[model samples]
Target: MSTSGGRPRRSRSTAVRRRPADRRQQILDAAARAFSEGGYHAVRLDQIADDAGISAAALYRHFPNKYALFCETTSGLAERLAVAIAGVESDQPDPRTELSELLATIATTAIDNRRTGGLYRWESQYLDRSDAEPVRSVVITQHRRMRTQLIRIRPELSRADADLITSAMTSVVASPATHRASLPIRDAQTLLRDVAAGLVDVELPVPRLEPPAPAGLAPSAKREIILAESISLFAARGFHDVTIEEIGAASGVPASGVYRHFSGKAAILEAAFWRASDRTTACITDALAVSSTPREAIVELVRRYVEVWCGNRDLIMVYASEIGHLEPDRRTALRRQQRINVEEWTTWVVRSRPELGAARARYLVHAALAAISDLVRLDRSSEPARIGPLAQRILLGA
Candidate 1:
């Protein structure tokens, strides 16, 4: 390069040159972090490019579009998790040692990737079925491996029991990725490993073998239909992707009729949040009223929570994932209600285990709740009968 004076000047290196493969990986890392922080719809490709220290054109050369990038980022993380599990040394003769080592490895990997590990949890739903299948397959394969080790350790556990326990352990390890709860790295790993290992020996409550009675017909009221359909649509496609017309069509009501029932999509979501909060509060009241001791109250609360969550999976799923799209005032109110719910759990947990300070108790409670919620989302066959007891054990840290 020549200077403006026409004399050849020393060429200045402004930017480091990177190989295409290296730059593509850099983009993936940045995209993972961006998607993890802001979710699928909220993050922009330009922001990811900037974070990767590349231009928008350069990013396009690597990834054709945002959705493609998102799919790769999510599936890539799942593949990484599978590979991490595959790398765990499993030659130990004692299955117990093998299981412990596996859990520890999982905890370490989850903690190490905590910043981006949560992408597959809530955001991967945005992927098309074809793109999502690879991620799902990877996760299932890892779960099967864990379940194998679990079955080896406990030869008598039914396959269903082992699957549930294995799911709970993976959820426990992955729980740290969902929240900002902090501990020293070593302490965090130990805490996760211990909680996961505890689930191996947990005696799951016997599942009900009887078939449930046939469901009754849907509600005839237009307002009831709108709310129910809206929750289902929101849970399945996300709030932003669902339109007022779609909700009306799903409910068999005209758009004009839907307006008479609720103000808009946001209003329906607000109503869903309120509905969940009211039901949860009622459960807490009922639990405390029926229990004479803190431990009893805790167990009752866990059972009630599992019941509520199971009965209203669509509503609860919307409640968990769509909260960010609500208006600030309503979001603030709902978040306050959520904290109150957590405080209720924390109080009972500390009362039952006095040695666990409020902070530690709260952390454990979050992990337990995350485990149940994640399991519910991931496992369609999850039964309240099995979940209630497993959740109770996790909450009590037994």
Candidate 2:
């Protein structure tokens, strides 16, 4: 029988044909899925080849190298994002209407590409600066356009205020990338749009955390630089993907000199983990000291948490993403440290909101932390300081 479109149905035994372009697209789609789930360092070329139903040598014929393939895939994804945002219904004169439309459109795109698209949050670091530039440009363009629209809609907003609000709005739609929370696409889109609206509708205060002074505890300046540079490299390239030579070059040390500060790469990683964990504990302690009540303490905790994270986004992201790659013993210790940090917040939240059982209070604390984590790969707007208070309010449910 012919279908409604008047095309006759093919026999069940008939074989479908794919054009060269279709084959190429199939490879890209397969590669994107493989890369996103396994990460750049963890995913092998043979794995991608298998996923594409091709031999490893055949895969090389399609793309020169893994780096080239990754760049192309990410650049294409960014282009899709640009197209989606630009297509948002813009005929409405009200800036708020446009904002809402934009957020919905972004949410739909994110949900549709959730399987492969969200992988960029973890994998984009593998792309070199030269390869990443085009993707960066496209994202910058979208952010600029969105921020301008936000300022027009709310004329009272300073450029910085507009940026903070825009980042928060973007964070809401981008939240899906950081977690595996599943919902119907329509429900997810609606939920994100409402959250974005709330973030945009509020006024955010400037962040108050002063820049941290260089710690006196480092063994030497060279060691500090090595640790600092290693964190940046690890954050950008994934722990397993980065080499000691690369870290040395970045840190202005020879490969042999790296051994002087730390016995091995894992040692550097362990030190970095402890450093981040210590900083987090210190921030929580200092914040609690200044707040008079449990409720205020929770608020301070949220604000300071955001402040600490924003300042150390690269170190923190790398630490969280690569902690699993560490030796089992070290990984377990760091995880316990992470639990302590969580408990600190959970306890304060329970004390402040007595009606919430420990279980529910812990959930809220995680939800708030999840919101802050959304800012990881997102570019900052002109007023990044406003994100601190906005995140704090989100944490406190204010």
Candidate 3:
């Protein structure tokens, strides 16, 4: 603190200086973690700022609102995945080689960004059309490429079969997003790569021919349309965020018209929830009725489950995400139905794999469900023909 000629020395703060661009990048990274962990509607800007060790004002200086922040988060994720996939050389003469390389890359990317990479599972539906289109294009293009490679690797597999195989493979690689499990990056990459390769190499039996479309009368067209559109809107925006007026408009009806089919907004959600639950139960019941043995029953159950999932992804997605918003009676009813489905699967699993015991069988059944749900979670569902048999194979431990 002494200076020459008795001049006083000025004290300076010791904080390290970061460029604005570096700070902005830090904010984006923090936002990604927050959005992935808590979802778009649940997370607050100030919370993100706190996580980033910055002020809310500083956060806004970089991104105007939560919507913009989410758009950036999703766009960044899509860009990274696109770049990683693009680096994969798909023209290799050996199709499995190409698949192995792609799986390694995807697994590594997923592990490295484990906290954020899986946000699309629950958050992507909330994206606006303008933002969703680019992300969707990136994801779908990658899917198509994988499906093409799969078919090339196994020419005997039908296109639908290829789609399912590719979806299952991708789901295995992206499994970390939904769970809190941790693994060393190298370990995760190796395990996921092996699983994806194994999934790709399996030769599943041909699916039983699907029964004819039922001849029963359909639900009222207007009511069905209203429910369908409402589900879409609810999926894209959290249930609480969407208005009945908006749902009505999306369904091509007046706001008052929505009242005719359902009592109110919550009622629409209840109907959607019940419909998804009821249909899922029916699919399982019908599958069981036709299978002669426990093993056959399990396979048929998974096949029908995947069939239901692909045909009703939006509704199922909405149901999974918004069931908490339903009234207590409807929520309990739906959950009860869901438990029954799980119990049915558990019973069949125990009968088929006696060594697994009831507890292990139950866990595996949930795991199998997770495998199928994560595919939907990651937005990778393709043709039902493909997803169904693949899920059946996974569930049967083929």
Model number with the top TM-score: 1
Q: Count the backbone clashes (under 3 Å) in each candidate.
A: 0, 0, 1
Residue ranges of candidate 1 with Cα displaced over 4 Å: 1-27, 46-58, 122-124, 128-130, 213-221, 236-241, 320-324, 327-333
lDDT of 3 by residue, 70-179 (tens): 88888999899999999998689887788888888887787778889756664456788887988988878787877877888778987656766787787777666654
Q: How many collisions between residues are there in candidate 2?
A: 0
Candidate 2 residue spans exceeding 4 A from truth: 1-26, 37-42, 51-54, 122-134, 206-229, 232-263, 274-298, 310-314, 317-385, 396-398
Q: Candidate 3 lDDT (Cα, whole model)?
A: 0.74
- Determine which window of 10 residues in candidate 1 has minimal summed lDDT: 10-19
Candidate 2 achieves a global lDDT of 0.71
Deviation in Å, model 1, residue 391 alpha carbon: 1.2
Quote the positional error of residue 178 for candidate 1 in Å.
1.9
Model with the higher TM-score, candidate 1 or 3: 1
So what's the TM-score on candidate 1? 0.85
| TM-score for each candidate, following the candidate numbering | 0.85, 0.69, 0.66
Residues 1-398, model 1: lDDT tens digits? 77799987664575456556689999999998877755677577898999999999999998899999998889888877778878877656777777887788888888888889768665456888888888888887778778888888898999889988998988887777776666778987887788788888888777777775566798899988999999989888888899999998999888999999998888888888898899988889999999999999998998888888877889877765666567668877976887798889889999999987787777778778888787777676788878877677777866
Q: Model 3, clash count?
A: 1
lDDT of 2 by residue, 1-398 (tens): 67789998877677475436666677788777766655566566787888888888888888988877777778878888889987876556887778788888877877777767655565346677777778888777767767877887778887766776776677667666544544667866776676566676676665456764554554459898899888888877678877889889988889899988898888998898899789888988998899998878877777677677777778867764565456667867876877778788878878877776665555445545666766643543222355556665544554
